[model samples]
Target chain A: MDPYPPSNELGATLGRIRGLVLTQETAQHAVDLLAQVAQETMPNASGAGVSLIHEAQRTSVGATDALVRTADDLQYDLGEGPCLTAWATRSPVMIEDTTTDQRFSRWSGAAAEAGVRSCFSVPLLRGRDSLGAMKVYSTVPGAFDEADRARLTSLSVAASALLGHVQTSETSTRISSELRESLRSRDLVGIAKGILMQREGLTEAEALAALTARARSTGIPFGQLTADIVNGHGASGRRGAP
Target chain B: MIGFPHAEEQRALINAAVVESGFTVGEVWLHYFSLSGEVDEYEVEAYLTGLMPLPSLECDLLALAVNELIDDLPPRRRAPFSDELIRSHAGSGDAE
Candidate 1:
């Protein structure tokens, strides 16, 4: 059943979703918009969520409500559900009636008890790697039909591309931040070493060893201990008795 | 034991044993990397398995190796001991 609006209206919805993907200043905003659009456009969708799968961890963001978050969290804990299957297979999985679905029996039974009678999970893929899944839930049994699944799949293609770009951008930003932190730590340690060298006339290794011994004795992180030394407080710069 | 409930606890006990034995952190790293040629977990695990029923004489060595490897980790990535196992096994041969 084609529950969505006529061709021109559906075209407008698709355009609006595409516009959101292009114009949102943050990936978080784009994902929230994606979930909102899924809930608004899909037939009988009570809520929607976006779930990202990374190395050994699964995080679902932009859930429309607590119920949606709970459903996604259940899938993350159990490691099985339409969302995970969709991500693994790089295809969509629809549960027309959660009560009768046997593939993810534990999750399905629990979801039904939570007033979710139907689900549709669409994979967000970028080439071979699956970035995540978009899941929509409905309170009515047999809520989603083939047309609803098709619409979600089409929307997910654009979403996947945008999410892939967002992930890459975020990763680059993190790497840059980490590089800057590493350089700062190095400079702090260098300054501390110079202080010890001038005060105690110690070699580089001896100065480093003295700092490390004090750090271990005081139970302070090596970086923080060095910062304390550079700031001239707490730890005395005088050489300890051998 | 494969079923040990606390991984970080085991690491802490081993680290203490190594430092108590007077081996420098750098020496431990050198010895461990010399044997394995890399700091791969599976390789370390395999090496540790070969030392099953870890002898008292070698316990500190093993502990040193593990501590040095863990010390190289980023601060946020380090998982130190946080269980009562260390207290229960203090100064006991079973800790080795």
Candidate 2:
């Protein structure tokens, strides 16, 4: 039997960590570029925005103008808007006229007051997962045509393929915690090895070997076993089994 | 790869246990690294696959890492006896 079978979870986790390391700056750059693409695709759009959301919270955002920023921020702040709905539903959302729209009443009212009369939002979907959403805002009602919608949808597909590999802040936080735990466990093992070395007059290799032997015999987890040794509950002086 | 007496046997036994324990090479290597096992993850993978050989000491450490991870795995759910369940909830709010 192959001792080390292929581990998809480990590979994916490592890939995410590698992505985080490689794309901390690039992720923001990519979003900014995608927002520019959205604006370029629809020249009539007053402004454009792109957001990478995690668990209903925006992790990264890019906007073509202040109007776009305001419109996108209001969605997160009010917890309802075209972009969020597109992301949640994993589909496109169009507001021909925010003033006449009743779906997201609070958002539409506020958006209209903020000078956003129309919007088109498309979810950035990669396979079964929705990464976030991209949107274009227009100051005039019914500004976008069917062709414009189709163009934006195509852009979203390309954007999703790129952004899907980018790591979010959430992943960085998780990696740090995992590293901290690994360090803590390593420290305990070091201390346990030192104790065994001092008490048994053994070299480092022999000390580790002894610890491994003890763990195997007791069927105890190495971390817990080391903690026991460090805390003076180990079989130090006693040679035979308790 | 060095040839010591029973080196292949030791490697085989360690590989068997690691495979049986269902641990990825990365997980085992991380724990082994924590225990001061001096081998990189790639070499460890190679060693486990029998493509390369590790020193006897490193082999033992790998075995320990696998066994510890196996020990740490959450055990199967066990049905509690009626008396055990009662005793667990018998404290009520007294401790608080």
For TM-score, the strongest prediction is: 2
Chain A TM value for model 1: 0.60
For model 2 the interface RMSD, in Å, equals: 2.9
A71-103 per-residue lDDT for model 2 (tens digits): 999999999999999999999999999999999
> Highest DockQ among the candidates is held by which one?
2
DockQ of each: 0.02, 0.30
Residue-level error in angstroms, candidate 2, position B17? 14
Interface RMSD of 1: 14.9
DockQ, candidate no. 1 = 0.02
Per-candidate TM-score, chain A: 0.60, 0.66
| Model 1 agreement with the true structure over A1-242: per-residue lDDT tens digits | 22322343333332232222222246567678889888887857899988767642564367888889888888878878998899888888999898999999999988888888999999889987788899899988888888888888888988898888875444333233333443466567778877887778888656766666665567566567778777876456465322
- Model 1 Cα shift for residue A51 (angstroms): 1.3
Each candidate's interface RMSD (Å, one decimal) is 14.9, 2.9
Q: B1-96 in candidate 2: lDDT tens per residue?
A: 378888888888878888887887877887787676788788998898889988777887887777777778989799999998678878674453
Q: Which whole-number lDDT from 0 to 100 does residue A180 have in model 1?
A: 43
- List the candidate 2 regions with Cα displacement exceeding 4 Å: A1-23, A168-242, B1-96
